[model samples]
Target chain A: MKRFSWDEMMNRYPAFFAIILLVVALTINFILQPNMFARDTLNSNMRVFLPIILLSVGQAIVILGGGIDISVGGIVSIVNTILATQVGLNGSPEKMWTFVFVSIGAGILAGAINGFFIAFLRLQPIITTYATSFLYVGFALFILPNPGGGIPAEIANVYRNTTPLGLPLAFYVIGVVLLVWMYIRSTRYGNYLYAVGGNAEAAYETAVPVTWVLFSTYVASGFMSALAGIAITMLSGSGNAEIGVPMTLTSITAVVIGGTALSGGVGGVAGPVVGAITLGIIQNIISFSRIDTWWETFVKASIIVVALAAPGIINLLRRKKV
Target chain B: MRKFSISPPVAAILLAIVLFLLSGFLPNGYGSDINVAIAQATNIVRLAVFLGVIAAGQTLVIISGFEGIDLSAGSVVTLTAILTYVTVKGEDDKVLLALLISLVVGALIGFVNGLGITFLKISPFVMTLGMSGVVTGLIIIINHGNVSGKVAPIMTRLIARPLSPDIPIPNAIIIWIIFGFLMWLLLERSTFGKHLFAIGVNRVTAKLSGVNVTATNLAVYTLAGALAGFGGFLVVGNTGVVFIALGQPFLFPSIAAVAVGGTLLSGGKGSYWGTMAGAIVLTLITSLLTTMQMPDSVRRMVLGATLLVMISIYGRQRGFRQ
Candidate 1:
């Protein structure tokens, strides 16, 4: 029989820690709300988390490609604004579909802008995205100065109530996302992503399409952010200029918790997806536990800090043992 | 380091002149009257002071290298302002004590961040990002979402008042000059400053060359927090009210100012004067946009596009060299 080692398992699967966290959070949530898995409650919860789950997958891809996209939220805001204003409160389904396509296109355009500056122009990923974020949010604000416009009730209800095979509609979306990610991971471009993120110079020397790979990651992130925006708009059943601001930091936190390294070339979409859900569950636990409203942000942030520091602390301990 | 070429600071000066000339086309142009120019200059200086102070610490951390950035600066500023106002409670006599306490609190937070980065090996980006959340949470907890306090009369006058009838400069401008000089001395004159640049250039080599890398990192982050706290005080003085969102806008502009000032986001290779110039340029750009009666959206788009162009000039050179 082969000997088992915790380190080997962690090395082989970077999501180990995140998986454990998710299990713990989910168990606590289940205990708090026994009916959490019930059809209605599950659908509502899944509906809310779906946006972040999609956002995290995109963020994970960017991080894996050895860059960070701080403008995801801005891109999300743009999409939300597009849908809210174009579809209006009483728009028909045809108009909604048309606007949805337009919103996605807008997201791709925003991502392309970021990618051109960072990948082709060779700007710092963080700074370039930070600058572009303002451009996106500012544009969103221009599109909808106030937070009043929203899609029709029927569209939102479709998002909220849809269930297929007794599972929430989000489950199907998640399934599709994972399937797509898996397929991409098996492709040559996927290998190129990891190689470039690990070391762009090394990858370039080995003849990888370094710049194109870099560009595509941001585009992918943009598309994902657009999806997240649509989900959020549907979930809220309204539009706000500032809706996407808070999501940016949360998405990054989710990426970190998912066991992805900020230095890049490690972790995957699964970890971040789990990380996003874990974050959502943690929020549920907090609310279910009846913590003070004031302490909610503090407690959640402290939890994130702890989560961020855990791997580093564990590595130090391992090194000491060695 | 190389043959003479136009650096960012020089470029900033040139840009300032071009902007000034362009502003001549405005109905109330800079050259229209001497008094108008002074008023405009003072306004720009006043706004730049807040951004410059926050960016000052950022410059130090970024100079110290290792992908150093302090995203929590804006949150710290907000927290410190709230703490200062609440503790002082509009009492002139309590200002000094409140300021001291705020500084200490800021330092403690910074120390936690440093500890996480140094001992736990957390990524600076993630650690600081988490710290921002924690600080914001603390603000909410303390204020319970109902912040109420007035800026101390003396503190308000200290920043807003003119130095004297003979001197047209506001006290804020004088204070900024002192802070700017001090930052310049720290970055260009001090041994710690030298070590920072060296470390930013290459951490292992700096460590091998006898730099106390850990100690330096700790000190820089602590100073950054303290400086951010001080910025909080200045902002409160300027606004005369303590609110959660007061310091929010400073977050990106501070970083942008540092980048616009020509500091390398990858760490090291920049100057404080460049940052000061950058801050002024940004404020000028905003003011000019407002003067032209452009909507907020257009202003933001212009700012974002300009930032992209600026970074492209700097980034292309660096990207190609590597």
Candidate 2:
């Protein structure tokens, strides 16, 4: 039992929720068709899962560091616009790489601005991020008023065309991210992040650089946002102001699903990563179930309701035992 | 005089106006006409009043803590507005019925939000956000994505008329101020209000000290919902037509107003009066943006900056102490 709990551990983070959703997804896939687990289905499911998973991971890190970012979606919109308009600005592969750097740079710049205000200026994270969201999305609209800019044909084709042998290059990239995250979580620095978020005054008393950790978490979140934007650029084939519209809340949903406390600390990358997959599966199951598109937003929100209410239910049930 | 420390939010509002004037003084194009400037100010005040009414209710809900919020305020407006237009459909005699039904609808939704938060033990963030989505779905379903019908003509006359023609004050402002005074009395004086503040300050302590934690929370949320609904009635009069995304924009700004006005996000110490001031500050800032000849981006950037400054100043005053 201990080994089971330790190995596939984070799965137990949202134990009831993860199980319920998995059962639902599996039941839907089976009723729909037995071939639902095959290559094409897997590819499509993973594709939808990628953005949320990336966003959630970043969200988890920040929340673990005791803050929230309502600006992730706005950041994605800004970065996606950058990739759309400037992805191939230099025309050469080497120059195009520079453009990518600039896109990432934009993310860092945005994150840095957020950090300065929240960390140094002593602003509340949510309020600072909320205002910045208005600023960033408005700026994105200024840059690209409409969804007209097309990615290089080759870039769009990359996401569209699947490989028989490798499935998708995006898969490898995510796998690398997971491994790196796991490695980092084992480091002492990661331990400090938990301490900082859990109780900043205590951490400061113990000599942890609370300010730097708080600031860097946002920067780290920014990088993840940039990566997600790049992936979205490949998938959407064009840039629009609304592409990342749902991302902000979706990221939070994923993190909470992964069992990170909104009060901060007490979570890891595994929960957010799994939560993202769970969300993807839920979306896939919903799309395959003949629900209208209008109801889709409703369903996404219902999952949040269920996810939120379930914890309370559990806490209440355990109250009797206590 | 000692209490008048010159709040940063108020200062930000003043600065935005000054910037507006500097961009184009009274002798220039849009600013040349007194009636026009006053007219614009009235519209901004109208918007601010509606936002303040809902935000005042938001203050009570949040003061009970439990990760408390009432994001559904916006959706309440949407649902109530849709219902009013459908039921009244422009009749004067039936206006009271429409208003009563809307109040009931708002209260019912608020009751559900409170029940889920207190009884089910859901996080206020996710529960309210999910409810917002569900309410939004209801809005879409009822209206079929395009708003049709009209408010009662009597309501249009009584609720929409300006109280002061000299300043061209919106009738909504008059309604807002009267009700807001009632809210202040309820929150700052009543025993129910005392229980709410205690719970907000520390739910555990309040419960240990014999406060009916669940009841206070439930009542607060219910009050918030009804107030939001009533505000929607006023909104219908102001706009004279309903739009789908009408309530969507108010959610963040309401929260912003509460925070900027010096309400701690954690709850307990705040004023409905300050929230009213906060809303006016935000509206005045937005109005300044309009009077200035600057492009939309610059205008938005300034707005964002003003919000940040306001939040920071309040945080300082509250001694948020990272």
Candidate 3:
């Protein structure tokens, strides 16, 4: 039998490092707040992290497809604005449901626009999405100019406080997402996605539907972003056009920390899922550590930087030793 | 014979002129008064100069390829501006010292970024994004989230004040012209330019062809950082105030300007002249929108849509098989 090598293991399971990092982060959080595992604490923490987790999963898929969707945040903003405005604070539950579907549809439409440009028109992904992001955010601003509207508290409570079988609502959502991802991963479309991302020309030559794969990734990202928008809206019970803007880079960071290569075709959604949660936990650790409030942003950022740079730095050191 | 075609830079200039002329029809815009028009034009150019200076670095980074981008440019600008303000403390004599400090700090940050990307093999997107976070945290810690300090009088005279009563032009414009010229020479007329293009086109091939890819990349990033630092100094001088997140707004616009200028985001081909024109075009659009008195939401939507349209027209990538 061949000996197991660390490099080979990492290559085979890109999320391996993310899992380790997650455990480390979780332990630190537990130490800082011994009751971290309590149902209430876990629910609150998971509720807050759900949106970014959703966003990161979508971003991972896009990265896997050899593209990126900077406009996802814009999509999130649009959905949030739609929900907050159309649903209103005291709107009927029926009205909220109607708007939820409408929001998702709008996300798909916005994503389709990005897809058309990048996949069909063959525009550069980064720039095309960057430009479209402005449009989406702008539309969001148009929808809710003052950031005052919100979903009914009754509806928001469902997303915030739901606990089934002693677990948070977010746990179910993540489970369903992972299950769906697994199903997708075993399908022909999934194979095609990887093939295209690994090498578009080769995939094209080998008769993979490269254009369709590329297009679908952005659509999926848009869909996930809409979901995230909804989750975040529920958590805040309010809306703001600027809320989603900062989340864009954070989602990207989570995906990278999860070990998904930006060059594409090398990672999966699980890593990003863990990475996003780890990020949230890091924030918790920062707060619980009793560090001065001024040091929070710096320490969080430094930790992320280290996380991003660590894998590469380790490889460099290993090579030098060899 | 080659077909007659206007280059991107020239076309951008023409578009800016047309936009300016169209804006004249709006109420309180440049209507029927040559002096007002000249004044408006000067103001547009002056504002564009700041963006141009920032975009200059963006152009260089984008042209260096391998998904090269400096997401940290904005944070560097913010940090440097604060540092300069604190150093100068409204004294003309300390302005030079402030400049030196800003450059060194910016360069140091970029060096770390380059080290991570070039040596540790971190992705440019992740490395810079994390670095921006780190820089943001640093800023908060340094100032405890409070910003104070005043622009030096001489610095203001150089950046914001008119050159002379008769000339009615800011000294910043003259400085930008000189800076642009030097940048043009660096990108188009120097051996370093050739190496940069080579590395951008194909890193392995460039290495095989005797280009020092690592050194060139490091230099490009360092230069970009230094430029952003200088931009920060100018920004404080122009605004005559210091604040946290001062550089946030410039991040997207800098990249947009580079794209509009016809720099290939995939790297290898670009020019600073085009970026200058792109900055002017962007500034013109903003001025026109403001002149029309469109609400902020509508303005954002229009800007996003316009960017998408413009990029579609000029930035289409080659088909996969091609």
The candidate maximizing DockQ is 3
lDDT of 1 at A142: 97
Residues A124-161 of candidate 1 have per-residue lDDT tens digits of 99989988998999999999988889999999999999
Worst 10 residues of 3 chain B by lDDT: B142-151
Fnat of candidate 2:
0.45
A211-246 in candidate 2: lDDT tens per residue? 888898899888888878777877786788668878
Over B1-322, each residue of candidate 1 has an lDDT whose tens digit, in order, gives: 8877678977876787688667876886776687887777787778788888888888888877777899899899999988888887788998998789878888888888889988998888889999998999998898896877777888877888888878878899899999888888888899989988988989899999999999999998998899888889888878778788877788888888888888888887899998898888888898889888888788888998888887776644344226
Cα RMSD (Å) per model?
2.0, 3.3, 1.3
lDDT of 3 by residue, A1-322 (tens): 9997879978999998899899999998998899999999999999999999999999999999999989989999999999998899999999998999999899889989999999999889998999899899989999888878898899999998999999999999999999999999999999998998899889999999899999999999999999999999999999898889989988999999999999998899999999999999999999899998888889899999898877887888888899
Each predicted complex: what DockQ? 0.70, 0.51, 0.86
Give per-residue CA lDDT, model 2, range B1-322, as digits (tens): 5585675446546654665455346444345776666666566677788778778778777677756788899989978877888888788988889889888899999999998987885667767877998888777677776766887767866667776566456667778778877887898889998998999899899999999988888888888898888877767766778888877777888888888777777787777877887788777777666655667666766777767776766664222243
In model 1, which residue pairs have backbone atoms overlapping below 3 Å?
none
DockQ of 3: 0.86
Locate the minimum summed-lDDT window of 10 residues in model 1 chain B. Answer: B313-322
Q: Candidate 3, residue A279: CA error in Å?
A: 0.6
Report candidate 3's fraction of native contacts. Answer: 0.90
Chain B TM-score list for all models: 0.95, 0.87, 0.97
TM-score of each: 0.96, 0.91, 0.98
